[model samples]
Target: MITTNIPKLRQFYKIKAILFLSLIISTSSCAQLLQIVEQTPLSDLKLSQLDISNGLKGALDKGVEKQVTKLTAIDGFLQNELVKIVLPEELQIIDTKLRQIGLSSLADEGIKVLNRAAEDAVKEATPIFTDAIKNLTFSDAKNILMGNNTAATTYLESSTSTALYSKFNPVIQNSFEKVGATKVWSNIISKYNKIPFVKKVNPNLTDYTTRKTMDGVFKMIAVEELSIRTTLNSRSTPILKKVFALQDNR
Candidate 1:
């Protein structure tokens, strides 16, 4: 019933083809966002060096704040399998011995107080860690942002471990005393020592627990950093979202 104009129909199809091509280019641009960043000259990067540095620092600070607070919570370290402080190798046999002697409850208390001391000591970490992160150099930031998922965490650990040891050691020692960990462990060791033909042992629990607590803290920070790098939901801040997006498509 209708006669189609071939010329007008050809024009309409040409317009449609042009629009489809534009759409394809736009989609390609989105898909190549990260590739473009990688290929972009360093001087032409959209984000400034300061922006990159500050963004990395901000991410680390958030991770430390969140995970450290969780570490300080009740049952945080004790209940968490990842960072749970268990008796050292020499003491594992002692735990078995205590259970064999039907004093499992006492053994339980000893272990509980150790984790409690770590939890209590972790409250001191935020201030020290904050200072360290705030002082990140521009070089540090660029390397970390471009490095592996846990690169920021690795930087924090390497930069702050010795200082954190000094900071955490005395606190853990005081925490052990405050929470009766020293007393409980003393009882445990005394009872174990009383067992005939057992080798005598005296361990520096302060050093041991401090090292373990720092390891746990770093471990948790690494987890948070990796989550932020790989999981969109973990990017809670604007900068975190934007900065981590570079690595997202990679």
Candidate 2:
């Protein structure tokens, strides 16, 4: 400027010089990084799409095998506090009232039968889950690979809930008959209904047990998935190691 102050002009030039140097340094750094990446071998990077898909399926299958199998065993639900099927809210009142009336043994059997039905129904779960895992797409693998610890379990639930329910409901219904739950609960409910001034109650035990069993299946699956995601020893396979390494980087 024709009448620019000397101090102001010097300050402006100094600021401009600093910005020019910063731009040059940033550009150089980016270029250096790009060159390094380009020279790096693919083996040092993430795995192929097919490898990732197999790895994800493997983890899901492992979860189904380990956790679901446990649920299928005798006393699986009855013994395991984590996935045990307890009485619903309305039934809890019945249990308390029955126990107060010196029918504690009968009440206990009622509860045990519910868990038995769930355990029986869980016997049908492994195949359904294995089929769902086999259908895992590459896109699904990519998303599940980058998702949180339970994301694969969440995906399995969403994909298999309908099929599992259809498969489990009838099995639980039959199991109730097979395991004498229907008789035990019938006696318990009859006794509860006869209690003085109590509200008469009729609940759908089959639907209730089916839902609880499904919840247990998914919960167990999530436990294994979390273990695999967090514990290196739990990976258990080379592909699992490589696929999850991508997640570790992310």
Candidate 3:
């Protein structure tokens, strides 16, 4: 090996180290500059309201499929309080009076039958709700997503109330017949009338039960909508998660 100057060699190493450090600093500075140029302000990035509305509509559709369909099944409304059908206004007084006179079991049966009729009738609700969802406009979705706890429900009622009533009425009539609601009420009223000192009670249970059942169905849907809106864990489905994530961002 040829003899080399130790001092020169040391100087050369020092220069190399300086050049390496300079290159690293320059690269780091360039990276920061690029980042500053490319970064976007969060406030400047606006989400599409239409997209948010679509997400809400999708969430509502999922809720109907998951929760509302269960109510149409046999004993569904009778068992589920959140969607349980109660006696209509005209029948409610009669039902209460009957229970007060120790006809509690009979009153209970009457209540059950009313719910049963609702359960039978709610088979019509799925198709009606489905149709309503199909007809939902962008504005409807936007308002619903940005609305209160019952916003989605209000939207549904506004758009589909008339059509749903038309569809539900005939089905409720048939359901009354099928579940013996009419017969039960007739018997209950007849028995109450026969009781000494009891006033006559002739309630139009069909109409009452129909309206109550419809209200119950809407109540259940609203419950589901509120749950998904407020509870992070309730967004269980993938679609629900993705859709609600959008809502959360808003």
Which candidate would rank higher by TM-score, 1 or 3? 1
The per-candidate count of clashes, in order, stands at 0, 0, 0
Candidate 3 lDDT, 113-211, residue by residue in tens: 878778777777787787788878866775676578788888877777787778778887887788787788788989788877766777776666667
How would you encode candidate 1's per-residue C-alpha lDDT over 1-250 as one tens digit per residue?
Answer: 9999999999999999999989978888765876566546444546666777778888998898888789999998999999999989977888899899899999899889989989998898888888889899987887788799789988988888888888888999999889999899888889988988888777678888888899899999998998888888988888877677666644
Error in Å for residue 41 of model 3 = 11
Question: In model 3, which residue pairs have backbone atoms overlapping below 3 Å?
Answer: none
What's the best-to-worst order under TM-score?
2, 1, 3
Query: What's model 1's TM-score?
Result: 0.81
Top TM-score prediction, candidate number: 2
**How close is every model to the real structure, measured as TM-score?**
0.81, 0.83, 0.73
Native-vs-model 2 lDDT?
0.90
Against the reference, the lDDT scores of all candidates come to 0.85, 0.90, 0.75
Candidate 3, which segments miss by more than 4 Å at Cα?
A: 1-50, 88-93, 96-102, 236-243
Misplaced by over 4 Å in model 2 are 1-46
How many Å off is the CA of 171 in candidate 2?
0.6
Determine the C-alpha RMSD for candidate 1 after optimal superposition of all C-alphas: 9.9
